[model samples]
Target: MATFGVLVFPGSNCDHDAYHALKHVMNSEVKFLWHKDTDLSGIDFLIVPGGFSYGDYLRSGAIARFSPVMQEVVRFAEKGGPVMGICNGFQILLEAGLIPGAMMHNEKLQFVCKNVYIRTESTDSIYTSGLEKGQILDIPVSHGEGNYFIEQDGLKSLQDNDQILFRYCNEQGELTEEANFNGSVDHIAGIVNKQRNVLGMMPHPERAMEKLLGSEDGKPIFESILNSLSVA
Candidate 1:
């Protein structure tokens, strides 16, 4: 069985949500890895979950980037280990330079907390391998700074390498400006690293893992990781 690790920082509130989703919902072995730990031994998949780490001081993930465990997370991702960052976790990945682009305050300057539709852009990575292109998913996003930004050159690189994983879209799976909740560049909702092993997104998949929450679309994201490990 694949062992999953969810990193826990001082201000992390969603760590347990991720733990429950992976441990009980997905039946995977899961553990909370403290921020001070340096070892990532026996962890096959790592998650940097959402929250206002370090009280979001200076910036959303600026302080959390220097956490002791992040060094190991960086080293693990450098070796192509599967790592996922959601919401503020995405901010951390950007701050740590594990993925491209930066996050900024929402265009509307308000915290967005609602279900948004996203279209799958690529299934070539472990996180989306079980999803089909253009499939619409109802995922909830709650954040004050979720706007994703990148330079033109880097944007071209991402497009050229097919690193984009999801885009904001309508319920019918049509991309539209009105569907952009936080004004991310090119309506991007999620993206993977060049190696396709690391993924960062602002939506909360762990919040949508069950039907009782209104949607189960998030299951395939975790399911994909489990499926990949079983095959390996």
Candidate 2:
């Protein structure tokens, strides 16, 4: 069975949610890796779940970037291991330099807590292998700083390399300004590293795993990881 690890920081409220989503829903062996630990042995995949890590004092994930566990996460990603960051986790990844770009406050400068649709832009990575291009997923986003920003060259690079994973879209999969929950550059909701081993997204797929939660679109995201491991 594939082993999954969820990194837990001091204020990580969504750690349990991610653990349940992977352990119960995906039937994978999951454990919480505290931020203080540097060891990453036996873990096949790692996740940084959404939460107000370190109280989001200086910045969303500024303090958490220096945590001991992040050192191992960086090494893991450098070796091509799969790493995923969701919401605040995405902030951490950006702060830690695992992925490009930075997150800013929502365009409306208010917290957004609701279901939003994201269209898959690529299926070349493990996170989206089970999904098809242009497939729309209804996922939940609860954060104040989810707007993604990057320089023009970086944006062009991501586009040219097909590193973008998901983009905010409407119910009909149309990219529109009204559909953009956050004013992210190019409406980017998720992106993978150049190596495609690390992914950072603002949406919380774990929160959308159950039908009772209003959508099962998130299931494919987790299943895709398992499928990639199985094929390996």
Candidate 3:
């Protein structure tokens, strides 16, 4: 059976959400892997779940990036395996070099938690394969240090490589400056690397998996991943 490895950091609080999202929602076998373990030879996909890893000190995801499992995540991503990092996981991916840029404190210096719409720019990556370019999704965003920052050249490269995946938007599903959740470069809410298998985003898609709470768009992201892996 195909299995996804979910990395657990010391303070990872969203590992269970990832498991639920992938297993109950996406219908895939999942293995909870410790951060100290570096070997990930058999997992079909890798996920770094969100939470306040390492107490969010030094910087969000800063200390957790040095965890042994990140080495494996990096290796897995390098060889074309799919990986995703949500919220704090996104921060770790950047620090581990699996993705680019760094997340700093929100410009408002506050932790904002609410449902936000995302404007999709790529539907070809493993994470967003079922989405349409320019499509809009309503997902929840919850964090204080999700301000994505990168050098100008890196930002340009992201654009050139089609790495920019999603951007925050308003309730009307329109891209507006007021809806830029954090001060991310070019209003980026998520990104994929050049290989397109690795994806990182600040929004908590797992939180939006149920229609009982008024949203289920996140279901497609995980579904697309499962389909891609099962087919591959």
Q: Which candidate is the best by lDDT?
A: 2
What lDDT tens digits, residue by residue, belong to model 1 across residues 1-232? 9999999999998999999999889999999999999999999999999999999999999999999999999999999899999998999999999999999999999999999999999989888999998889999999999999999999999999999999999899888888997889999999999989999999999999999978888999999999998997
Q: Model 3, residue 170: what's the lDDT?
A: 82
Off by over 4 Å in 2: none
**Model 1 residue 62 lDDT?**
98
- Our tally of clashes for model 1 stands at 0
lDDT of 2 by residue, 75-125 (tens): 999999999999999999999999999999999999999999999999999
Better of 1 and 3 by TM-score: 1
User: Where does candidate 2 have its weakest 10-residue lDDT segment?
Assistant: 208-217
For candidate 3, which ten residues in a row score worst on lDDT? 169-178
| Model 3 local distance difference test score | 0.87
Which wins on TM-score, candidate 2 or candidate 3?
2
Off by over 4 Å in 1: none
